[model samples]
Target: MKIGELARRTGLSASRIRFYEASGLIEARRLGNGYRDYPEDAVQRLEVITCGQQAGFSLEEMRALTLEPTGGANRHERLLASLKGKVVEIEAMQARLAQSRTHLLALIAGIEGKPVDISCEENAQRLLARLRENDEPHSQAT
Candidate 1:
């Protein structure tokens, strides 16, 4: 099929397909008429590329997984490791976000619980001390 057909089938633009080809993520053969021809399997390859990108894989990482040789063994093992590593990174990010959220909620509660009798300067000092005490944002979410 041609670039247009591939783009329609993949829901990607022709330029994106060309960019992938240029970036060595996919390949196309040139016909005698100066047109690019693609095999049926190219559709599957493009799907995998897009899906990998959606799953947080960079173009370079996608290129490595799809292009690099893994010694003819169960190539899937390398892919599996990469997927697991990404999951770990995502989990760590989730933990950090959870802690940050807890810190924000704590600050909000402290502000709302301020004693009306206290002067502004004293209230600020109290908040400041509270902030200093919880500076790490390490509070665990229940």
Candidate 2:
């Protein structure tokens, strides 16, 4: 089909499809009239490409997984390393979220008990320290 039809069917822009083609994430054949012809499968391929991107896979990573066998090159190692890094990142974020929740609860309790501003500040500092300590292990693991 034509580029416009492909874009409409895939819910992507024509330029985006063209860019994906140029980036080697997608392929198209040139017709005798110099227009690009795409298979019906191109839409599904583009969908997979975009979904992989949203899942934090880089173009090169997506290409390796979808386009060909990885052949046990550094690509596999790199993917593993990247996944480890993401795991560490997620753990750290969770630590921060827990800290924020703790701090918020403390603040609410202090307000309900009519505590002084200085007490709230001290409680907040303690919560922050706990968060830092919790995140330390994740950081060191990375």
The TM-score leader among the candidates is 1
Best by lDDT: 1
Q: Tell how far residue 37 is off in model 2, in angstroms.
A: 0.6
Candidate 1 C-alpha error for residue 72, in Å: 3.4
- In candidate 1, position 132 carries an lDDT of 76
Q: Report model 2's TM-score to 2 decimal places.
A: 0.55
Tens-place lDDT digits, model 1, residues 1-142: 9999999999999999999999988889999999999999889989999999999999999998988764665678888899999999889999999988987887788778889999867887888788777774566633
Error of 1 at 19 (Å): 2.0
The Cα RMSD of model 2 versus the native structure comes to 6.3
lDDT of 2 at 74: 70
Q: Give the least accurate 10-residue stretch of model 2, judged by summed lDDT.
A: 109-118
Residues 16-82, candidate 2, lDDT per residue (tens digit)? 9999999887789999999999999899889988887886678887786667654667767766776
